[model samples]
Target: MAMTQTQRYGVFAALALVMAATRIHLSLFHHDIWDASWGIFFLAGFWLRGSARWAFPLLMAEAVLIDYIVITNMGISFWSHYCVSAGYWFLIPAYGSLWMGGSWLAKRQRGLTLSTLGMAVAVLLVSEAACYVISNGSFYWLSSHVPTPKSFTAWFANLGDWYLPFLQTTALYAGLGAVLHVLTVQMARTSEHHGQMQN
Candidate 1:
């Protein structure tokens, strides 16, 4: 079912709110919930598939703004924050990987069948892996934060240490998103069926 303009707007707002609410790790509202920034981007991609020209940039801006506010709130300049570095810019492509993954899944999603679920999981794995490589690998190799004398062995170890945690967090949110997607699709189908019966 095609979404109305209002529905799209509503989804956009909800995603933005989720990002704001969870992105700030130190915020009182956060309660230490794992950051959903990565998953949010994927969800946005799935839901807002063709809106990348604008939606992606808007969400990206919001992420950066939230980071700025959080870092500056801690009495440090945003630029001086440990996470801010040359490698930070790589997030565009990293998040884009998730968005593309979501868009890819959206295009192929047929129903709540096992095949669909399998495809979703497969897409998530590949996309998240790509995202991790770009985000983590860049940070390890290019960011000034990492100690000097980087090696493939060291980076591989670093990847092993953090990859699962990142993937788990993303999967958790993606799972919720998937459930929501299924519910919406089911509801729409029911509504249409009812309409046809009435005719």
Candidate 2:
């Protein structure tokens, strides 16, 4: 039951659309309490299948589109709104690397549950670190609009303001992502077993 080229393309295209929609929906509707974007799902999909070249581009495009829509609707400047979107190119690779590493660990560990948890945490930490460093540096050094913090104390305070919410969001999303990965793997195993029994 090997997938044909057409089938593979279809799968990739469908997943890309789904990822885009999920990201836009989450960004718009799920802004309170916790934000659940296609980021985790993209990472999980890449983990399960390997490279997510299409997924990453689709995710970034969706983010940019959402930024435009939000800006137009809210009467905000598009540049200001899209500043966050600009970081996705760097952030996606950081998380994607972690996902790939996690997938390797899962393969090596013979499908242990703990391996999945470790992968999720690894993804979270890598993503947060990459985003924090890149985004903060851009704000401080590159961007003229964002006021650079004057002192070390001010910079540290700014870092806390940027990092804390990100940490909380990543923790919540990573926990959910671990659970989802486990459930998906379990279901896949169950289906395979059932198919074998039928055969």
Candidate 3:
């Protein structure tokens, strides 16, 4: 029941590695403008359970790995990509902490009626704010270098076009994340119940 420090470290390390691998694979093959990938889920997981000291370093390493691959293979600028990628990690603590807190509140309330909604909203706002700031800022910087539509309004409009799609995708991911969390909690409860029955 009680995890040793080494066990915890190993678990965290394995999770981080799997997260990095999945993100890299998705970036290489299945990534699209509208598709949210495992990276988001990984951050959500870390936020839900991981310590900031552990999660931040893992996130930074993952970001650096992905940036190197993207720059080498896709010809994207590493600096710009790093800027945006770094933002995801920056936002993870706030977003994740809120979600974790919301879940705790829901537990105290003994239902998912009002508490769930509050938590969901909190998660959404944190996610959206992070996405908006990072994506928009990255796009703005990249736009200056590339041939984008000429005008702040047009630039934002284009950004909006991409933003809405990804937001939708993130919402879907959030829903999935919530379901996974619930399932995990249920399984733990069931296991505890079984252990009690045996005793």
Candidate 4:
């Protein structure tokens, strides 16, 4: 089913809101909810691929703004926050990797099929790994947060510690997104079939 321009805009807005809410909730309110920014970026790429020129930048700005607000609320400058460092700028490419993955999957997706699912999983794994490496690697090697004399073995070990949790969280959200996508496409097809029958 083809989407109208208005519908595309609606999906874009919804993705942005979800991203903001989840990030803010995790950082400020719940403190337990995993931030959905990563998943949202992927979803945004899938659903709003053509709008990336503007939408991606807009989402990135929203993320930075949320961090600024959260850090300031804690009486700390955004720049001084432990999580914000020289390596922090690497997030653009990290998140971009997820977006590219989604966009790639979107182009190859052929509805509810095993091949589609497999491709999605494969892409997600590769993209998530790339994201983890870019974000985590930069933090470990470039950021002042880490002590000098970093060893590859230690860094590899550190990667193992957090990689699974991040991947699991991203997969969980992406799985939910897959379910929704299937339902939406199925419903649209059914509606189209019924309309054709009526005509």
> Top model by TM-score, which number?
4
Candidate 2: count the clashes: 0
lDDT of 4 by residue, 1-199 (tens): 3578899889888888988888999988876788988888888788877778988899999999999998899899888888889899999999999999998888879878999899999999999899999999989988787887999999999999999999998998888888888899988899989999999
lDDT of 2 at 171: 63
Tell me the lDDT of model 1 at 119.
94
Positional deviation of 145 in candidate 3, in angstroms? 2.5
> What does the lDDT read for residue 25 in candidate 3?
68
Where does model 2 exceed 4 Å of error?
1-30, 41-45, 80-110, 148-152
TM-score of 3: 0.64
- lDDT winner between candidates 1 and 2: 1
Q: Candidate 1 lDDT (Cα, whole model)?
A: 0.90
Identify the leading candidate in terms of lDDT.
Answer: 1
Residue 136 displacement in candidate 1 (angstroms): 0.6
What ordering of candidates by lDDT runs from best to worst? 1, 4, 2, 3
Instruction: Please give the range of 10 consecutive residues that has the lowest summed lDDT in model 3.
Output: 34-43
* Candidate 3: stretches off by over 4 Å: 1-18, 30-50, 74-114, 146-151
Name model 1 segments beyond 4 Å from true: 25-31
Model 3: per-residue Cα lDDT over 54-93, one tens digit each:
6545655665577578666887766565445433344444
Q: Quote the RMSD, in angstroms, for model 4.
A: 1.1
Instruction: Give per-residue CA lDDT, model 1, range 1-199, as digits (tens).
Output: 4778789889999999988888876353555698888899999999998889988999999998898888888899888778888898999999999999999998998877899899999999999999999999988888888998999999999999999989999999999988898899999899999999999
Predicted structure 2: lDDT: 0.55
